[model samples]
Target chain A: MFVSGLGYIIGETFKGLYRNRWMCITSTGVVVVTLLMLGLFMLVNLNIDHITETVKEQVEIVVYIEDQAAQEAVNDLYKQLSEHRQVEEVTYVSSEEHMRRLQMQLGGMLEGYDSALDNPLLASYEIKTVVPESVVELAEEFETYPAVSTVFYGQGYVENLFAVTGVLQYVGMALMLGLAVTAIFLISHTIKLTVMMRRKEIVIMKYVGASNWFIRWPFLMEGLLMGLVGAVVPLVILYYLYQYSIEWVAGNNLYFLSLLPAEPVIRELAKYLIPLGTGLGIIGSTFSIGRFLRV
Target chain B: MVEADNVSMKYNRCKQYALEDVSFSISRGEFVFIVGSSGAGKSTLLKLIIREIKPTAGLMKVFGKDISRLPRRRLPSLRRSIGMVFQDFRLIDDRTVSENVAFALMVTGASRRDIRKKVPHVLGLVGLQEKAKERVCDLSGGEQQRVGLARALVNRPSIIMADEPTGNLDPGTALDIMNLLRSINLSGTTVLVATHNREIVDRFKKRVIYLDQGKLIGDEQKGIYTHVR
Candidate 1:
């Protein structure tokens, strides 16, 4: 009995789709466009997150040591910097190493300062905070140390980068949400039109004792099929697009511009997109057919 | 069997009742006609029997159960036990006659093999066996109503309520539908028809329930259409 009932529902769903093929195709196209925009925005947001994370990792606070500070004071400052809860990692750079780095930067001018006795650069501890936003606060704490001469973490650049990334995340999320609502609205209106066109047939069905579900199953299935196809099309398209973009970036040696790897992004998008698409479809069909079922 | 007692129905915010103090009971195997002028609430009474609308007051029962309070989930079973036909012939025009009939059985969760066997038999009963493959849009008015009848009878319901089943047909075609209904009634399936076709109603000389202005004015065995003043 269940098999035959299922057969009937499947048969009716196909018949409904075939009969209204043009409408189905138009609605499906709408879904495809909506999902494509949504997926694109999602990918952009994901890549932005990756880029910001990499940039944040490069932000380091350098606490310069006073040249006259005693060795024990320097050791105490280093211990304090390491024990701070917000600190992720700290590396000590000897004055000699600092001079060597300076020499590499100003090659010909640093030839006279190669000896440790003549090296004028102060030793420093490079501090990395667990969160980039706390870099300024951590830098201030280091500045209060007696052995620390000064602190620098490129404060202006780091703050501006964080602000921009925060705005990008919010805007991306809002746009995706708007697109999802629009997609649901479009599908719902299309389903409404189909339901209106079949009003008489539904009346007949009701009179002939078709249960609410018997009448509803076909429209629900139609919506589900549309949503599934819509999600799959964009996912396939985005996967290849992202792959090609990644390959192009690698081929051109654009090391500064980071694109997230293709596989994980596509997989994550698929995880959410498929269910969302299908859920929107079901909701649309359910709303459109609700009034007619009261019979 | 069907029964109604003091059943009244009023549309929202409206002072006038669509039906008032209507009382009737139909026994098994009865052929009854509800004859009245337009706006006399004939259709409303039929809709009440089908439980499409609940009576605003008093009690209504069908198949010995109070359907006025029947739960929504159980409505399908109640509706399945009673077949209904409409004035518009309410057939899905794009589908073939056989498909139209099979839809009735399909809704009841009948097997495909049962539908395959039952559809042709019902179509044959309505004398549309040869036209089973023809689309409803291609058929004449009488033929379409016959298809509607075939759909109604396909499920083998004990009661058939038709709201002006012949309303769209010419006099001759209408008479043919009435004759078909009468024959089905003779075979012991209870039939209730709501119509204003005075000529056939008088010619049939069957039990008639007459209504006027939302009130029952006359009911008699072998009654004429104009017996009520």
Candidate 2:
């Protein structure tokens, strides 16, 4: 009997959909488009994070040591820099190696300046910080070192990256929220139309003393079915777009855009989509039919 | 059994009384007819009995319980004790005849075993066993009325309030339905039928309550449809 009831409900839902074909189709289309736009923005945000992380990983703080600094003083500075919690790795570059690399880089400009052995470049300790905020603190701390002449970092550029990504995250969230609300509203109205067409049946059911739950189940199921169906196209679109993005980044040698692993994102999305679609469907149907079923 | 003591129902903030100071008692296994013309408060009295609408004054009781004070939540159980057959034969169009009859049992949480056993028996009682599987839409007006009767009797309520059960049927079909109701009342179910069918009233000669413009004009045992302005 339960199976028969379920089958009857499913059959009736399809019949209702067929009767309001234009409304159903239009609502589904709206859901798909909104989800697609939201998904695209998410992908873009993920890639941006990947690129920012790669950039942060490459940025290193170089602390130049004074020319007259003693060997022990330089060792003390290195220890202090390493003891700091923010430092990931510390590498020492002697003044001679620094001058050799400078000479190699400026080979054409410094061709005849060989006798000018005043290689003002100092023995530097390159420090990699774990987080962006630590870079400024580490730079300031290095300036207090007796062996360190000056401490400089690309703080301006890093701050700009942080600010831009923060704005993007907010914008992405607002856009997704707006689109979700609109999609739910449209789907609810569509289900309302379906309910209106069967108002006579509902009225009879109520008069016959059928409980509110019994009357609500079939319509809720109908909405859930529509939501599930509506989600399919957008999920497929999102999957292909993710795959294309991974491939494009990999092909372009954009190693920076690899923060979100493709497999995990896809897996997480699959887990989220089923429940999200079902919930949206149920909510839309319930909201639309709640007032009408009050009797 | 049903009892009403000075029951009055007013609507729209006491501007009009649908039923005013009406009082009557119906016993089990008795057949009574509430005879009234259009707008004579027949439906309001029925609704009050079923506890679908509450009375504005006085006390009403059904099955030895105060119906006027019954909570909205308890109305379902109260209604279950009284079978109501509407004039329009409110059978769901999409359901088969057997399903329509089973619905009454279904709402009261009757066991599936009971439904399977009893639905066919009630349909058989109403002489519609052959048309059990046919959709209600396929049945004629008279057949559909029979289906409604079958549904009402399936639960074996002590009282049946039929508001014009045969209003849409021809005289022949209507008589058949009346005979069916008489048989039901004979079998220990009190039947209260509200109709304006003077021919049925005069022919059957059952107890009748005559009403005019929401007022009870007369009550008689085995009465004829006699009323003067």
Candidate 3:
């Protein structure tokens, strides 16, 4: 009984949608635009995560050693750097190893001038901090070490990166929420007009012994189809655009930004956005029909 | 099939009542007329019997069951046993005559085979079988009321309550509808007609319950419209 009734209701809903073709298209268009905005914000979040991972990887402080420091003092400084609370890992490079690294960096120009000229490169401890933002404060602390000559961390760049990401996260969520509510209201308002137009049908149904649920089923189906159309169209367009974005970034070999690969990210996004769009459609239709059902 | 005792309905807390101290009972297969002019609470009485509004005071029953205490879920089944026709005829203008009649059966969970069979039978009873494929909007006023009557009877309810069924028809067409309703009543379906049509009320000479200013002033056996102008 339920299956056949459901089939009938679905057929009726299809008829209703076709009858209200202009409204359906306008409603679907608004839903697509709003969902596209939501998709863009999600992309922003994914890329922000990617950028943070890269920045974290490159966020170590380098402490250069005093050239005339005693061997014992250098050993003590290395031990302290390793044991510091903020230091994640510390590696000590001897002056000879540093000289060899410098020779490699300078290429053949600085090669083969060894012990007689002495190792001019300073020995350093390469430090990785637990938090990228802590690099500056930790670098200052390392400068107080007895054998440390200088501490280097790009403080302004690190602070600005963290600050910008924090603001972006806040603004992205606010815009997404605001736009989502607007979409629901807009879609439901349009559906409300359709419901009003069909009110005579509802009154007739009520008089003829149709249950409230029986009347509601077709409207619910209509809402679901509209939502599916709205969501799927933008999702396909977003999928293609997302693929193009990844390819463009890869083709340019852009050093400033690194996005996660398209295959997993777009596929993962599909798993969430499609259901969300459908849910919003249901919600919108429910809003439209709520008052009418009370009669 | 319906009972009421000292029933009253107040639409507002601070306003006068729509129905006050009204009491009546209706038996199965009894053709009755609730006769009154405008503002006599005739429609309000019907609405109360259908549980459209809870009586502000006293008890009302349908099919020997107290309706004031009936559960919300049970209302549909109660209404299914009693069909309603409105003054406007309330046909879906967009649908064909056949579909309009079939809609009544479909919503009540009738099988497709039953709908196909019964829709034609009821439309034939209303003498609109030839016009089954025509949209209701294309039908004349009398034809449209016949379609409404077809819809009301398709469900085969024990009782049918019509509010001013002939209000939109000419005198000749109104008499034709009255004859159709009388035949249905004779065939053992209870009928309640709420109307201010004086000539039909006088000519039919049926059981009449008269109301004036939300009060039941008289009940007459084979009564005519007795209100003074």
Backbone clash pairs for candidate 2 read none
Best by lDDT: 1
Q: Between prediction 1 and prediction 3, which has the larger TM-score? A: 1
lDDT of 1 by residue, B79-155 (tens): 88788888998899888999899888988888878888899888888899999999999999999999989888988
Report the poorest 10 consecutive residues by lDDT, candidate 1 chain A.
A1-10
Q: Give candidate 3 regions above 4 Å deviation.
A: A1-6, A9-22, A52-57, A66-119, A144-147, A250-255, B226-229
lDDT per residue, candidate 3, A1-295, as tens digits?
A: 4324778887778877887778778777877887777777777677877787687678788899998999999889988988888888998877788777777788899756764476667878899988777887788888888989988777677778778867876776787678667766766666666677777788778777778888888888887887788778877887788889888988999867788877687777677667766776777677767666554
Task: Give all TM-scores, in the order shown.
Answer: 0.93, 0.77, 0.88
TM-score of 1: 0.93
Model 3 clash pairs? none
Residue pairs clashing, model 1: none
Off by over 4 Å in 1: A1-8, A107-117, A251-253
Could you say which candidate leads in DockQ?
1
- Count of backbone collisions in candidate 1: 0
Worst 10 residues of 2 chain A by lDDT: A1-10
